[model samples]
Target: MKRYPTVLTIAGSDSGGGAGIQADLKTFAALGAYGTAAITALTAQNTQGVRAIHAVPAAFLREQLEAVFEDITIDAVKIGMINTVDVVEVIAGVLDRFQPPFVVFDPVMVATSGAKLILDETVGVLKTQLFPRATLITPNLDEARMLLKKPIESVDQMREAAEELIAQGCRAVLLKGGHLVAARLYDVLAVRGEATQVFESEYIASKNVHGTGCTLSSAIATYLALGHALTEAVSLAKAYVSGAIQAGKDITTGQGSGPLNHSYAPKPMQIRS
Candidate 1:
């Protein structure tokens, strides 16, 4: 007998269908993984900016996690847009109970349109309670600056930042360098005892990159569920996101930052015995 390689995305909902849970689910389906979600909050936003946010209660969030874990055989997990410390704790507890194989935490601090998402206090809780539980924490340059409380201006600084983030108890860190002012984009991956690795990609000039972080992390989790190792998964995921951006470069979805073409190359769900 065979079953789909399922991934659970414990994140928030985006009414505009660009980022947050919407992007996660879209990436999962595009990469051929069965997608599941336990929403932590709801945001009324578009490609322009966030208007309002309604957080899901901790009890209901726990119920959602239990309901999914009790039924599906989850292969990998992706976490995004956690709004409160309560939601963070609830998710940490549930993850501790289920112990999924892969947990990619996208520490989404700010939206692409310069809107803050998570609270300052919640960031501390996430670092303490959820960092150790996460398989890899993917933070953009700005988020890294918030976490490290310093500047990461150059490639060498990014590598140093990745190492410092791993010291915060996470097993590994993928410090994104999209914000760096350079011709080519670079991302550093630092594992606990392994040597750091750098991934370089051509800088595609496109405004439709609103959900690149959410999409990349979810794609990495999907590749992990599909049996790729950590480094391999990141490489494949970067390629997928680059392709999505290039494919949707000319298309216009909203007045502000648009979204990547997640379904640019859809694949059928994969089966596992």
Candidate 2:
């Protein structure tokens, strides 16, 4: 029997099922890749906001990573919500050992509802250890601002931040523009020694965008696992997220922000070759 491309998500678990490991797995399955997860934290959250978070022990997190790596061939990895320094170190150690082909770091320092997810200490660990190992670091405006320790007010600022992140050892950076108060959504992809590419899309007016970032990163990882180039994967992932936002706009999953329609254009899994 042929084997399917497998994408793994190392992140927190959102009880709301809209973001984090839940959204990552949904995006992976929708994009025709098998999904696995190693949850770093369990959060009591909803569309409104996060109420509480319980982080898993670092040893257990390592065990989860080992269990998956020993059993399945992880084609790509999407890492999100490493809330503590120990958690970040543990994940970094696992990645160093396994060396997955495509490692996409979402750098989920902040949540959609404006909650701080990662601790200050973990930021240093992420930049020192995880950032250098990532194939691509996907950071939204707030996360970028925090990482670079500067305010990003415009697309120009986004470009500058991407360059700085690249200098910190990230192979590539996808600086997200969702938080920008502009009519056009612009995402900048910057790689070392290459001209940066900008992905522009019409900003869809939608409140159901809770997991948009997670879904997009996971989609990119899935496409990359299926052998798409970085630029192509990001372009397609942006389009997919835009469509998901549009599809889920009118639906209400909770009292506040809702989830994207991850399976809106779901395709049947192809026989692995």
Candidate 3:
């Protein structure tokens, strides 16, 4: 028998089991990948909002990465919520050291319930240090606006913002257009030297949309681990996320916006020769 494709997440822990490392692992598991984590922070958060945050020491975060790399054969890495310059540097250092095949970054700056998740200065550090190293960077419109220091409220703006993000650093950019108020959703994907592709789907109205960013980025990383090309991986990932959102819309988990149905219908464990 063959082993499952191993995927690693370097992000924060969500006690709520709906976002961050929890969501990443669930996405990985549902997509038939072996999931591992190197948590950067511990957040006391749930469907409502983040109540408290305890940052993990950079040294400890590095130790976790080293342990994961040394023990498991990771096929891809998804990075989220590196909320400090020190931890950002540590992650960049470890990433440079390992040079993993595929690294997907979800620049998570704000929570669904309107809480700031990262410091302003840390945004600069992430763009300058981490973006260049990532194979793909997925940022929602709000995060895109934060990065570009401008507005992104239209599909035209999303295209412009996505292209600009690519010019700034990441090898490719997937600017999520979920923030736009519309019935039809367009997620812009701009890769280096390729025509931009917009993945459109009917927006599922769901208040339980807590972990989509984490889920999508991790889903893309899992598809990459399964040997899909970057754009194709994104396409597949988008489909997975759409299904999850729709499946979870009718379910209830908490008073606040709940989570997607990641495991409602999981794919079989993916194997590689």
Whole-model lDDT per candidate: 0.94, 0.92, 0.92
Query: Please, what are the lDDT tens digits per residue for candidate 3 over residues 1-273?
Result: 568899999999999999999999999989899999999999999888999989999999999999999877899999998889999999999989988999999999998888898987899999999999999999998899889999888998899999998888778999998889999999999998899888898889999899999999999999999999998899999989899999999998988999999997898888887
Ranking by TM-score: 1, 2, 3
lDDT of 1: 0.94
Q: List ranges where model 1 is wrong by over 4 Å.
A: none
TM-score of 3: 0.98
**Which lDDT tens digits does candidate 1 get at residues 108-152?**
999988989988899899999999999999999999999999999
Model 2 has a clash total of 0
Q: Residue 272 in model 1: shift from native, Å?
A: 1.2
Clashing residue pairs in candidate 3, if any? Answer: 208-258
Candidate 2's C-alpha runs over 4 A off are: none
By the TM-score metric, which is better: model 1 or model 3? 1
Per-candidate TM-scores read: 0.99, 0.98, 0.98
Model 2: pairs clashing at backbone N, Cα or C within 3 Å: none
Clashes of each: 0, 0, 1
